[model samples]
Target: MYAPRSPPPSPTSRQLAIIRFGLARIVPIDDEAPFAEIAAAAGLGEVHVRRLIRHAISQHVFQEPRPGVATHSAAPRLIAEDADLAAWVRWRADDCWIAAYHACEAVARWPGSEEPNETGFAVANPTSLTMFDFLATQPERASRFAAGMRLYAAHSDLDLQYLVKAWSWGELPKGATVVDVGGSHGEAAIALARAYPSLSFVPADVGGRIRYMIHDFFTEQPVHGADVYLYRACFHDWSHRYAVRMLQALIPALKAGARVILNDVVVPGPEEMSPGLAAGVRTGDLGMMILFNAGDSEMAEWARLFEAASSGFHFKGGKGHRAQGCGFWRQSGRDIVHS
Candidate 1:
């Protein structure tokens, strides 16, 4: 006799909406409300609410204790308590869901474009504008995206403290200047300043809280010959083509012996990632693919990127942090070794 086999179940938009609806209304209460009440609050039909509730229960998002009464469970309660988690869920349901829905059509149409505007997000919204530009036009979605990033850092343990502890910042000479390229609001610089009082920082970002001149990374870096040019969670947003441009922009400003440190994901090779970390890393890779046609780089890919970016950049090595990854390198006197 052959062993039994069942088809794998795929996720549906209805399932996402069900969870989103549950998150919006279902709270811990004395009495469980019937499906009709939930439907009224959610602006959904009674029969539709009943089916959604049943699906949600199967997914462990909500619970149905009695025949018709729906109540809060552990998962829904957590979403209710954590504002960031709730915002993340909302972003997933509203933004990412739509983007993913339109991804197939985008791929078929654009084929292999690396521009951010060529992404599924653009196709879904029927705009040629990039994500940032589009988000700028829609304040609410932009706010949600910002909140989602902050919350994601909490979820992934990729906070300022991790950067402070992961590197050897104290070893740098006193008064050494560290430029945070593409560092929004200078949070990393602020954290480093606290950890290493002997050093100074320059933040190259718009609307920064610090007292530095605003500069774009795509343009020539204004602060030349800094001790270090730090890129935290920035390079991964671009494809190798644009990433090389960003590095080239910084090359003229890099003095001899200047270090280039990256605080981003170093994607693991096949069968290399631990089971616990595989999901997060792969999801991140997929997210970049959908949004910008970019991706996290593996160790070899990182080295190759530096080589391709400039003949002067040398690939030192890389390692993992709590959840984030690190790549270390410096401007070499000799020509860069091609992979």
Candidate 2:
């Protein structure tokens, strides 16, 4: 005989704005302030702050401590850890993205130069500042950015470890090499090497970042035959024209039948086609678009690039292959093999 509870209302645009404002202030969820204190800090009226917090909590961005107090929740925590999320939010709030939003107004007034790059503020407002560039200009932002990446890496590492463990490594030769392309700080390499003691790993990145790996190489080289190579993420941040150049750079060093791993997202189909999977893929794709205007490849795209490489190497069937929606190919001398 008890009355049924009503469903919470969906979030409104105004509520979303307030939530974003709150997120910029409160990071590292473990440290949170009282509602009144946060409201005053944000310069919003107490009633308005309360209403905004209430709405945010319902949307799972903020968690209410009691009736009036709230703290950051999983959604914001996930967002904080994501570099792309940070970049997207910054872009959306930035003058550049804001101007892009109003680009239609200018187009309506003058019909010429309709291309996004020509009219959109993202291109016109050339800050020449990448997220890393911003970090260089604003040291504090860099610290926050590093902290966010660490959080993301920690979470991602866990998932990667699980995948590594779940997949059968029988396909690999007894002493085969596993090269981790764009490996950051050697964490992924260390994890995989530790899990599969028999396998050798080479952690590759840019020259500056590789210095730390050089020290590790000298100390642990004999033990694991570990080597570090330097290549820039800058190439990956560009179009296929530059991405092909980046891939070509690896040709001289690659060994036949060696596993070359590209640890990046494989974009999914349209959102309407597969809601949950598409959401995850597009989330990553958008992040790439916002942060560097970089294009992350789909499986087919990866295969094409692999075929075009000097070695003409293709990715063979590997762990999480089907789930990732990626294709496989192989290389023999200059001939490319696709599956």
RMSD to truth, every model: 5.4, 9.7
- Tens digits of per-residue lDDT, candidate 2, 1-339, equal 999988754443433454356543553457666777777777777787777677767667678777766767876675656655564444444433444454555455435532223233333344444444544776644555565555544443235554355444435566555555556666655666666666666554332222223332112222132222222122335546546666566555544443444444444345323565556656555444445445556556766777675545664523233334422111101212222
Write the residue-wise lDDT of candidate 1 on 119-180 in tens digits.
88899898999888899999978877888888765554566776777667788888788888
Cα-based lDDT at residue 301, candidate 1: 82
Score every model by TM-score. Answer: 0.85, 0.56
What residue pairs are clashing in model 1? none
After superposition, candidate 2 runs with Cα above 4 Å error: 1-126, 156-158, 162-177, 204-238, 255-258, 269-272, 314-339
lDDT of 2: 0.49
Worst 10 residues of 2 by lDDT: 326-335
In candidate 1 the C-alpha lDDT for residue 331 amounts to: 16
